[model samples]
Target: MALQEYTEFITELFESGKTHSEIATELQRIGAQSCSLMTVRRFCSDHNLQRRNFVSDESLGCEVLSAINQTGPSYGRKFMTGYLSTLGIRAGEGRVGRILREVHQPYNILRRQGARNLNPIPYHAEYMGHKLHMDQNEKLGMFGVTHVLAVDGFSSKIVANVTMPVKNNLVIYNEVYRAAVASNGMWDQIRVDHGREFFLSLYVQEKLSQHRFNTNRLPYKQTTSSKNLRVERIWPEVNTRVNYPLKRALVDLVDTDSLDMQDNNTKYCVFNLTCQVSQIGLERAVQSWNAHRIPGRGIPNTLAAGGCPQRISMELLPSAAEAARMYEDELGASLSWASAFGTDPFSSEEDRQQAEQVFLQEYPDITVLFDRAVNNDLSLFQDALLCLINATNRFA
Candidate 1:
């Protein structure tokens, strides 16, 4: 019954023009072997059944080609696929790729090459001008001082480093820029420790660039990337090792604030120059620190006090007479002789110009800063202030 039934099923299907699948299913019910698939192909070939192939109409292709040419060289295979799909002509990727190549004229194949990575290319500490690092401590609703630390990585010099108020943007910006410009026309890269003050708006970049110096508004980051490291990683290291001496002078150190400033501002520095001291006494002050922080390589770490100086005038009315006297007291005494330095300076015209390049190394700023009025008398706090100025000026 099984063999007879299998033979009868195929004979009936073949006569009735049913496909081999129908014969196979009938045969399988009677436990037949799996040989119907090859039989179907062989029968089809023997009968010479004409296979149907799908092709777009030549007129349609001409229309499509015209539609394609109507547009510029912008459309590629992707665009063609989308356009064809809209017209109910779903084409394969291979066809589209081929059509795009021929119709698009000279087809271009894309290729890329990478270089063998060499040593890391170091980032420029300065942008158009110099590098400025800034940090501001929040007062935390107290009378405590807010620290603004601005250092120039190029020089390892503190441009405008001092403690003030959390809300003291004027003091920070005015002083920092002054230090930067007096020596090096405004800062280019201003790195900060992500503090409130150092974070500037994009408008600030435009505004600052409006000045003489051109500054690109980069987000002074604190990474060690050769492309754009904010240069903060090196700051703490310098603070402890090469510049360890300045740590004692500074207080309330913020780990991140140094980063905030480096991403923002550029400071003054004196490297590779014949240095001249602003005053002998000021030199003595920094030199004294050498006892604690002596230079192994001829005072490699000479530090300076106070910001860049500019002679600013004050007008006081005669009605309130003590204004002139008060100004003198605030600045302290004008040290007739220079202050103490942790080191000495070259006392020559050549040295003066060279030191002027880096305000820190060349001429020690008058730390006990006293802005004596042009016409004002230096009678009031002159003596005490001068002593204070001298003492601070002598820091190395």
Candidate 2:
């Protein structure tokens, strides 16, 4: 094929942030004739196709400051550069580092001091959907919060995550595993720690094993949490970004005697409120994680956004709702939709609805309530607790 014929293809790849050498290699891979790095570079120059760059140091500094404010100051040199690339801004690692040091000296020093010793683990997957790793985090469990996450082993992307009061098998299956399957298609193998919370999901995986793209591997594998490297690795990030702050706020409630965990109504109200707030934090963490680049590998969202190349037949994969029905059929029980919050503070569904109506009438905006709670405003917690108490008392 003529070089001119590859123009559109090269342009598309370039716009997606591929280097000239990478574009050239892709052209050769696609059977283009006489495609070379120099040829690709020349073609790009001729077509005026160039990578976007900050026009000046001052402008670059402004963009860097904006990103830091948005993503927090924990972003190191490489991550900041990669994140900027995702925003269509390209800058050298040296310049990014210099700007970061000049701007956020304290975080830079702390980052260097707090860097952990690396102990690399050998891991591999043939393609995107080859293996799925699942795990639950209970760092905030004492405060009635739990998190379940599913990560794609090949792409290092968090395929699915959910926040709940505790690790429930049905919730893991429906919200995490089945949700992942629905979004990313079926994986060749599922890996998880030997937690009973995963039993339902694993059973469903085994039942559908034959439908996997590669049937040679077992449908699921159970191992120690430590050995489930991919999913386990993500917990530190979650702890730093989501768990730690929320845990501190919840603990303050206990220390201040503002939240009575021992009381059933208080526990229910706190659990529901905390679960909502933790979910907001978890979502922000997931977005930051997926968009931030990993060294040697590209951005997780970019890599895994393209559905699995070795995707199993979608027709064979059940939707989350269908999987729930299938689980009920196999287990002879309907899945409970109650999260860690359990039932409402009221005695019956009707009472619960009435209580919610009263609560909504007083609170008016649950979003603002959760937002204030997430910002570590302890007063919001007290306000919510007081509101819930009054609402439930009216129902009683």
Which structure among the candidates has the greatest TM-score?
Answer: 2
lDDT of 1 at 132: 59
Query: Residue by residue across 273-301, what tens digits does model 2's lDDT show?
Result: 77876786677667667777777888888
TM-score of each: 0.27, 0.73
In candidate 1, what are the lDDT values of residues 1-396, reduced to their tens digit? 223434555555666866656666666676676556666446544554323333454544564475353222333454445445545565554566566655545322310121222335464533224555555433221212234445555444444444432334334444444444454444454555444443221123223443424334452444323323333433332222112222221112224232121211111111111011112211222222221221231211232222222222122111112322332355462211111112233345565454344443423443221111111222221332223223233331
| Residue 314 displacement (Å), model 1 | 17
| True lDDT of residue 213, candidate 1 | 41
lDDT of each: 0.36, 0.77
